[model samples]
Target: MHIHASLRFPRRLVDRRLLLSLSLAGFFVVHSTHAASFDCSKATTAIEHAICDNETLSQLDSTLNEKYQTAMANLSDEGASELRKNQRSWLKERDACNADAACLENLFNQRKSSLQATTQQAETQLDAIIASIPADPANAAYQLKQYRGPLASAWLVYLNRFEPTSGVTAEEAKQRHQVAVTALNKQNDFAASLLKDIENDPKTSKNVAVLTFLRMTIEQGRYDEVPPRPDVHCFVFSRQGDAAYRAFGALWGSSRDSQAPICPPQGNLFELPAWKQLNKILDPVMSAAYPNSGTIRYASYADWAILRLRATLSPTDFLKPIEGQSQESPEKRISEWDDKSWPKVQREQLLIAIDPARKATMEWLQTERKFTASDASKASTAIVNAWLNEQLDYLSENLSTGDQ
Candidate 1:
């Protein structure tokens, strides 16, 4: 959770030769007679200036195309076709780049509108540009039609990548809220299973508590740990146990209160009857498998692995009770609460589940082995891909079931 905030530019930008070439190309574009003769000063308004610049660039583009075509006249038909295909691909990338620039400009305008002092100035400039543009109905209609195809395609691509389209009906808005809900539920189920496993291991209760504490520390965005002791595995025990314990108390105490409605009211917070019953069943099995000090320290971890496996195989009905608690219906309890509160808890829980291993590995690599950014990055790809695949499988399965 404690992401390093080093400002890194693209590696391509850092290459001296690439930088020199870019500088020369930029200089050529800036000093070209066709580019310089645009007469931007002649236009009295922003919109007029923009239009004039675009028109001049279009002319320059046409001239360049004519020269390129003449130079390529000796090429065979197959060569010409291949060249055309490459040109078309380049054009597609250029158009997408320009569209992204326009989108950023729109976003800037929106942000400017949100401030009291800048709002009037931004609105005035926008209104002046709108008023200055001549509204030719025929041209406007044609441009509007031209815009729809790419806009629709872009929207579909975005929805498919980030949102969901699996169960959307024709009558519904393209936004798939059900898909999002189902995905979140699956993640929550996974986190809950991991938590249950840790809580259920009586023989390794101290180790489980320590791990839960370390995980909570990471979730709270803390990363101030001394290098692992020569004799100790940092993942199993940290020198800064006090910091870890404090983080655990804060995170889990708050979570227990938040989830109180879903569990039976009990006086002993750590000894919830449902969880205690599970501990009794799992403790003996764990003790038999891990009889030594070194392996016993990892008993909680093995318990978590088993829980993760069981979570994948368990029926959806196992989660139904909590599902009802999480329902978005306009019941008094939910309607009065802010929507963001519960999700923030869920995010914290998931982060806590995964953070101990990540932090320990990072600490080991950085403090012990002196890993470079590239080295750490190479190691992280496998970790990230495995997590992504697990989440994707959960999403695919739940979506297929129409679980929402």
Candidate 2:
């Protein structure tokens, strides 16, 4: 459910919708004395003449005229002038269809749909704004301002990209839901964290308002359920291609150098010095290729990166010498997502899907073979946060960044 910016539409669409909006609002007022949108006695064109002769069309024309007159009177002087100019121009073009009933009907429908009433336009604005909000807590306060408008009942409709998804069998849907549960749970936790941050703010009233509107949707049964999260769709290293490989290679100046086994990625990637640089390279490639990619991307990166690093430096360079339960071996950790199946070419990489939060399933895959709930929780947070910070920052830039 991508909501493209309405303002980005073509010029014709904007013009047609403007006419349609005015037409719908004023079309059926049923003014008998004023029976046409224009002066009937002066009508000359075949289409204009046809409208004056037909009772039904003459009624519709009068309705459009009523709306047009009211709108023009309320508009600013410049706006009224502009409308007058555009309408005159449009009438000329419209009349070219003459008495072609199909063309005339099509024209009416196009404008009507294009020009939603004031209320519908406002609701659409809310959806576009809410959907574009940053997933990070830092931007929550600024983004919450958009929730000020009345939340349209339609806004509550399910925003999930997965449900109503066709072609998947019941078992597959169940599995996908299972994988999504963790993410959904994580999203709920994140939302709670943001609410807490908002509460600590000096302006609690403003924050509460945003939450109230969101709750309205739930109560109205627009969304299927709370805890919004997407299903895990692929392995961490699942995405790779010549285009992706090119972006990866560009991380280093030369292709050969980028592919030449380098361990521990040249520098810190998620934060500080390398953060901005990494985002510049990763954002476009991710958007064009793996827009839906998630936690797996970061985890898989660690795997292959460590695999390459093992080529030169000792893998032990990566770990702490802590005892038993807490101790981490770089070799063992890398083995969690990789094995002999590692591909020579990234394009040929094999991907297997597994729920990252499912402790039992992950344990069976031998990832740290015996991760306790506490241990797994700590590991998941650390890895996921690293991934999320990069994601949030990238999203902040890539999403509709304008203040609309």
Candidate 3:
């Protein structure tokens, strides 16, 4: 079943408390004073009244709003819209707290911390994008124009009068390119840190986590900005058998321009022992889940399984060319997901029935996929790793779709 992209899972109260404390750790450093993001005199709801009444809660509101505004300043129109939607969702949750000071504080702190991280990351990206451009006034001017986003508006305005034909020294551009590459490499290193969080609990990590990590790699190429290609090979290769190896490969594997010398020599990934083993595990489950063939088969959960796996499989797997496979190209395969008619009723029934085949898969996910085998043998470890990835795919298929 195709999952909705916006599904959110319930988080533990301890998670919220921990987040609140962490967010508040640096709170006083910037926000020692108290004020609400809005006018207290105009406070309407119980949630708003609570924030207006409590000094700490008012400060938290003001702090998050400040960070939110800054983040909005840096984002593209589309990004801003997404952030706004998320904030609205957060507001709904916050209002649900209704006069609970602790709940309001926790939610406010979490939002504040998230906004700060986003703004900082966007600032770093904008800086790198600026540095990546050739020092040639015209080239910079023209490239800056393409940005059109709020993040690049200042640079565009500053360089607006320059003619496209004007030139700068190649040596200067080379130095800037080197700096840009270094900045991007650092960004990748930061991404590695995020990957480490998932690696620490790969088996337990949610579908949202996996999908977010994969989405991060979607813009890896950015070749138009920096042609040298920032080296993410070390980032992925170092984490082999872990989530990073697979997540980082999603985009790099598909982009023809990304098959560069920066990575190890390529081989057909599907033929790899680990990949074949994963396929082996999935084959039966998918077959049992969707026994029918033809038109209905095209819309089966099995189809989504293939798409999700390809999306998360390591680039090393996709690096090698397929020999005698189905004639459908990758482009067509991606488009198929959106175009095919969804068999919602049959899918709903399948979810409700919980047949032996489905139960077995769930049992595997809950048990073996939770941790490596006790012996920790190389083969056992490989199988466990394969199972972990399969769990991620399974979670992606069902959890996000609310079919659980």
Task: Provide the overall lDDT of each model, using Cα atoms, as 2-decimal numbers.
Answer: 0.31, 0.35, 0.44
- Summing lDDT over every window of 10 consecutive residues in candidate 3, give the lowest-scoring window: 1-10
Give the alpha carbon lDDT tens digit for every residue of 1-404 in model 1: 01001111123333643576788899878866333223545656443344345644434344444433422332233444665675576545444444343543443333223332222332233223222223332332222222212122222222232234222232332332232223223434333333444435453344334345224222221122232112111221122332222223212211222211111111231133433443343344234323332322332233223222222222121223211112222122212333232233432333343434334433434444455655544433333223323332232222222112
- Tens digits of per-residue lDDT for model 2, 158-273: 12212232232445433433333333234343323332343354533432323322332222221222332111111111121111111121121112122222124322222333
Residue 389 lDDT, candidate 1, scale 0-100: 33
Global Cα lDDT for candidate 1: 0.31
TM-scores, all candidates, are: 0.15, 0.21, 0.32
What are the runs in model 3 whose C-alpha is more than 4 Å off?
A: 1-34, 135-151, 163-404
Candidate that scores best on TM-score:
3
lDDT of 3 by residue, 1-404 (tens): 22221211123433654586788878867755457889887888887889988999998888888788767655656677888899899888988896899988888888888997787676565555555443455655455444334325433422221223434334533443343334334445443343335435544344334433333433333322433434322332333323332233322111221332223323332344544554554444445444233233322233233333332333223223322122332222222332123244433333333232323333333344342333223223232333333333443343322121
Question: C-alpha displacement of 319 in model 3, angstroms?
Answer: 57
Q: How much is the lDDT of residue 349 in candidate 3? A: 36
